[model samples]
Target: MSDATTSDPGTRARPVDVSERVALLDVLRGFALWGVFVSNSFAWFSGYVLLPRAQAQALSAPGLEAVVSGLYHFFVNQKFITLFSFLFGLGFSIQLARAEARKSSIVPLYSRRLGVLLAIGLVHLVAVWAGDILSTYAVLGFMLLLFRQRSDRTVLTWAGGLLVAVPLLAPFVQHYGPILLHGAQAAAQAAKASNEIDLRAKEQLLAGLSSDSFWTAQAANARFLTHMVPQSKRLLWMASILGRFLLGLLAGRYLLLQEVERRRSWHHRLLFWGLVLGVLGNGAGVVMQRLRLAGLVDPARDPWMLAMSAVMEVGFLGLAAAYVAAFALLFQRERWRRVMQVLAPVGRMALTNYLLQSVVSLCLYDGWGLGLIGKLPPSRCVALTLIIFALQVPFSHAWLSRFRFGPAEWLWRSLTYGRRQPMRLAPGDAPASMTG
Candidate 1:
C-alpha cells in the first residue's frame, strides 16, 4: 500500500539524522508509559476484577480506596494505552512516508520490524507475563496495510465511525463476559478442590500466579494466556486500537503535529470536547460500578450498565485525546516545552523502557523474585510505580546522552536491515526536534 515498494527491493531507506527527531513525540511516549505502567500494575501482575471487592478495598485507606477506584477506573484505566496505540500508528505512518519519499523498499523492512515485535511479544507472553499487548499490536499491524493508500478523508470517515461505534458495542461483552468467566472460575475452583494434580503441578498450574521457576512460570503464563486471549475481548479491543491507530495515521499523514501553533482553535475544541465526554462518560461508569459494589444493584439486570459501559469506553478514549490536546497546547509554549523535554530520552527509547517495565514488574511482583504477587495494595502499587519510573527517567537520560538509539531500538533497526545500525551520534549531529 505504501510506495515503499516503488523503488528496487534491494534499495535501503535513508538513515535517520539526529536533527530530524521530534521532541514532542518522545515526550508523549514517555508520558504515556507512566500511565500505561500504572494501569498495567494491577491487571498484569494481579487480578483486577476477580479479586474480592472487600479485599481489594482493604489494600487502600478505608475512604481513599473509593477515591482511588473512581479515579483509576474513570480516568486512568484503558486511557493511556489508547494514547500509546495512537502513537504507534503515528510511527507507522512516518516510517511508510519516509520510505516512499526516499524511493526505497518499505515492506521488507517494515515487515521485519513487526516480526521482531512479534517475537518479543511471544517471549513476553510465555516467559515474562501473559498480559502482553505487543503481540496483538504486531499482528494487527499487518491489517493496517489495507488502508494505507486511502485518502485522508476516507481514513478520517472510517476512523471517526469506528471511534464512535466500537466503544458503544463493548457493553455486549460485559453482558456475556461475566457468565463465561464465572463458569471458568467455577470449573477451576472445582478442579483445585478435587486435588486433581500433584502438589508441585498443582502449584504451578494454580489459578493464582506463580513464577518460582522458568518451567513453572511458563506453565502459569500459558495457563493464564489461554483464558486471557478470548475472542470477544480481542475483537473489541482491536476495534478500539484500530480506531486510535487510524486517527494517528491521519494526523501523521497531514503532519498536523508539526505546526501546533497554527491549530490553536482545533486544539482548544479537542481539549474541551474531549474532557467533557471523557469525564462524564467514565464518571457515569464509575457510579455504576460503585453501586454494584455497594450491593444496591444487580449490574446485569440494570439496563443502564450497558449504556454506561459503552459511554465509558468512548469517554476513556476522549480522555486520552484530551491528554494529547493538553500536551499539544503546552508544547506551544517555550517554557513548558523546556520542562517537558526532560521526558524525551525516555520516549526516544520507549521500546527499551516498556520492556524494562515488564521485566522489573515481573521480578518485583511475580513469583520469580519476591513472590509478592497479589499481596500489594493499590496505593502501594501506585507508589512503587512512581518510584520505578522516576529511576528510569534519570537512567534514560544517562543512556541516551552517550548513545544514538536505545539498546533494543538499535537491535531492532539492525535486524531490520541485516546489519548493525550506528549506535553513536556523529560529531556534528545533535539531538533533533522530532524523530521521523
Candidate 2:
C-alpha cells in the first residue's frame, strides 16, 4: 500500500471511516475470538491450569476426553492468540498509513489510543482476570512506533528475530542462566524449591477463585498478577506477542488484505507452508506435552525440553498463518463468503466480545457465580465455549444494527479523542461494511 499523503497537513486525526474498514480482518478477528475463548475456557476458566499434574490427568478420561484434549493442544492452543497479536500489529500499520496520508502526526493520536487501551487493560487485569493482554499490547505498542519509519527489510528482520531466534534461545537461557550464576547443584535445588513455591501459589489461587466472595476472588487474582509481573517467563511472552504485532504491522504497511486477489499466489504458498510446518511443529509438541503430563519429561531436567518448546512455539505461528491463508482463500468464494460473513459483526466488536467472554466465563465457573470451576470436564468446557460464541454472533449483529460503534469501542474512541464519538447511525446510513 502506497503511503497516504494529503495536500492538507492540518487535518485532524480521527478514527478510520466505516467504508474503509477491512471485512476480512473483522471476520478473522471474530474467528480468532472464538478460539481465544476455547483456550481460556479449557485452561484458565475451567481451573485446569491450577490443578496439580495428577489431578489434571485424572480429569481427562481415557477415551473421548483424552482425544479432545490432545487435539486441542495440537491445533488450538497458542494459535489464535498468535493470530490476534498479528491483527494488532496490522491495525497499527493501518493507523500509521492513515496518519502519513493525512500528513498528521501519529504519535499524539496513537499514544492516546494506546493510553486508553492500557487503562482498559489495567481495569480488566485487576477487576476481572489475570490473563488480560491489552496492557501488555499497549506497552509494547509504544515500541512499534520506533519501527514505523524503518525500511520493510528492517521490519521483517526484527520480527523474524523476535519470533524465531528468541524462542529457540529461551530454553538454553532458562536452563543455563541459573546454573551459570549459582552452579549446577545449587540450581537444581533452587528449581525444586521454586516448583514447590509455584505449587503452593496455584493452590492458594484456586482457593481464592473458588471462594464464594467476590472480593476474595479479586484479591487472589491481584496476588497472582503481582507474582507474575517480575517473572522472566512474562518477558518471553511479551517478546513473542511483540513479534506478532510486528508481523501485523508489516501486513498493514503493504495493505496485505486489500491486495489479497493480487497476491493470491503468495497466500497459497503461505497456506501450504503453514500447514506443513504447523503439523510438524505441533505434532512434536503434542508428544512432548503428553510425556510431560505423564511425568516422563521434566522441563527443568530434560535435555530435549528446549527443542520441544521451540518447536511448539514455531508451530503456533505456522498454524495461525495457515488459518489466515485458508480463511482468505475461502472468503474469495461466493458461497463461503456468505456463510462466513456472520462473523464480521463479531469481529467489528471484538473488544466488547473479548471482555464479555471473560465476564460470562467467570460467571459460569468462578466461585462467586456458578462455582463450577474444577468441576466441569474438558468436554463440557469446550461445549460451553461454543455456546457462548454462538450467542455472541447474534448479539453483535443486533447491537451493531442499532449503534455505530460497539460499547467498548465507543468508550475507547471517546476517551482517545477527548470527545464522545457519534454512537447512533443515521437512519439512511448503511450499516458498517468492510470495503477497504
Candidate 3:
C-alpha cells in the first residue's frame, strides 16, 4: 500500500548509458555490498558453519550476540539482498536498452552471461563456500527474460503476485518442511553415530573449518552443500529475489533515477513510510522466528508461520525501497555524497568484490585458513567486517583507477561478449554494459 514512484519528462530522454552511469546506483550498490558482507559475516563468524546445518539458526545466544542477531534480523536480513536483486534487475533493463540501442541480439548475449554466472557460482559453492546466490540468480534471471517485453503493470503484477503467493502458499509447502526436517534430523543423528570419528574433534574441525589435512574441510563442505544448496533454491528464496528484481525493473523502466530532483518529493515520502513499514514488517518476522525458537509457536504450524512471514516479506520489500529512495535523495546533496562515492568503485567492480569477499571470509574464518569461526563473537565479527570492507574501499579505487574492470568482471565480460574486453582504463575506454 505504501509503494510510490514518479517519472519526470526531463529525465526521459536517453536510457542509462554505461560509460556515463548514474553514479548514485554504483554508490548504492557498493554500500549494499557492505551490508551483505556484514550479514554473512554474522553467520560465518558467529557459528553458522559450526552447528548441524538445520540447527544453526536454532542456536541460543546471550547479550551482545543476541542483540546483534536481533538487529541484523530487523534491519539487514532481506534489506541488502533485496538491494542486490533489485540491482540485478536494473542491470538487466540497462542491458536490454543497450542491445536495442545497438541493434544487437539480447537473448543470446544475456543467456551466455547468465550461463557464465551460474558456472562461477557453482565453483564458488562447491570449492569455496556454500552460501553462493549467483547460481540461483542465474537461474531466476532466465525467468526474468519472459517478463522483459511485458508492460510495466504486467511486470508489477507478476512480481507482486509471486511476493504475495510465497507467504500464502507456504502453508502448503511446509507439508514438506516437517517431513524434510525429520529426515534431515534422522540423517544427522545417523551420521553422528560414527565409530571412526571423535565427536569433539569432528565438531571442532568442521565448526572451526580448521584443517589438519588437505580436502578435509572441502569434504565437509561438499557434504554440507549436498544438503544446503537445495534448501537455498527453495521457492520462497527464488520468489523473494525475483520479486525485488521486478521492482528494480519498474524503476529502470520508468527511468525514475534520471530525475532525482524532480522525484525528491516522492523519495521523501518513500523514505518516511518505508522505514516505518519496513521496521514493523521485518520486526514481525523476527519476533515470529524468535517465538518459534522459544517453543511458543509450533515449528510445524505452517499457517501461522506463513502468515507472519508474509508480513515480514512485505516489510522487507518496503524497507528496501525506502533505502533506495533515501539514497537517491541523498545523492542530490554534498554533505554525504563525497564520502559515499568511495564505494562507487566497489560497486563498479561488484562481481570481483563479491567473489573476493567469499574467498577472503573463508580464508579468515573457515578452518582452512585462520580457523577463527566460533572464536569471533558478534562484536569482533562486526569489527572484522569493517576492516575487510575498509580495505576494499581503497583497493577498489586503486584498481579502477587503472583498469576498466575487475579481474572477474573482465573475464565475465569477455566471455559474455565473446571477445577480449579492454581491461586497462584508457582515454577512449567506454563500457557498453554493466560489467558486473
Highest-scoring model, TM-score: 2
The collision pairs in model 2 are: 4-101, 5-101, 89-248, 89-249, 90-248
Which 10-residue span in candidate 2 carries the lowest summed lDDT? 1-10
List ranges where model 2 is wrong by over 4 Å. 1-10, 433-436
Quote model 2's TM-score: 0.96
Which candidate, 1 or 2, would have the higher TM-score against the true structure?
A: 2
Candidate 1, after superposition: displacement of residue 357 in Å?
A: 0.8
Q: Output the better candidate (2/3) by TM-score.
A: 2
Q: How far is candidate 1 from the true structure (C-alpha RMSD, Å)?
A: 5.2
lDDT of all the models against the reference? 0.72, 0.85, 0.72
Error of 3 at 104 (Å): 3.4
State the displacement of the C-alpha of residue 424, model 3, in Å, after optimal TM-score superposition.
Answer: 1.5
Q: Superpose all Cα atoms of candidate 2 onto the true structure and report the RMSD in Å to 1 decimal.
A: 2.5
Per-residue lDDT tens digits of candidate 3, residues 1-436? 0011112233322222245666777888898898888888877544554555345543437577678778878888778988888888887776676666665556876788889888988898888776788888898989988988899989988888778776667754654555576786664454455312434433644642666443776677666665454542366778888888898888787776657887788788888888888988987888887887677886444445646767877898889889899889877888777767777888877888988998888778766677776666566787888999999988988887678778888787777667787777677554323232
Off by over 4 Å in 3: 1-19, 49-60, 176-208, 301-303, 427-436
Per-residue lDDT tens digits of candidate 2, residues 158-216? 98888888888887988899999999999999988888988888898899999999999
lDDT of 1 by residue, 1-436 (tens): 0101122244556345455656678788889988998899855565443344566666654676556656788778989988998888887787777777766645777787788888877887777777688888888787777678888888888786676766565665555555477775674465465443334433444344554775666677687666557646577778878878888888788775656777778879989999998888787777777777678886445655665546777787789889998998998788998888888788887878888998888778756667766677676677788899999998887777678878878877677667887898767655432232
Estimate the lDDT of model 2. 0.85
Taking every candidate in turn, the Cα RMSD to the unseen true structure, in Å, is: 5.2, 2.5, 6.5
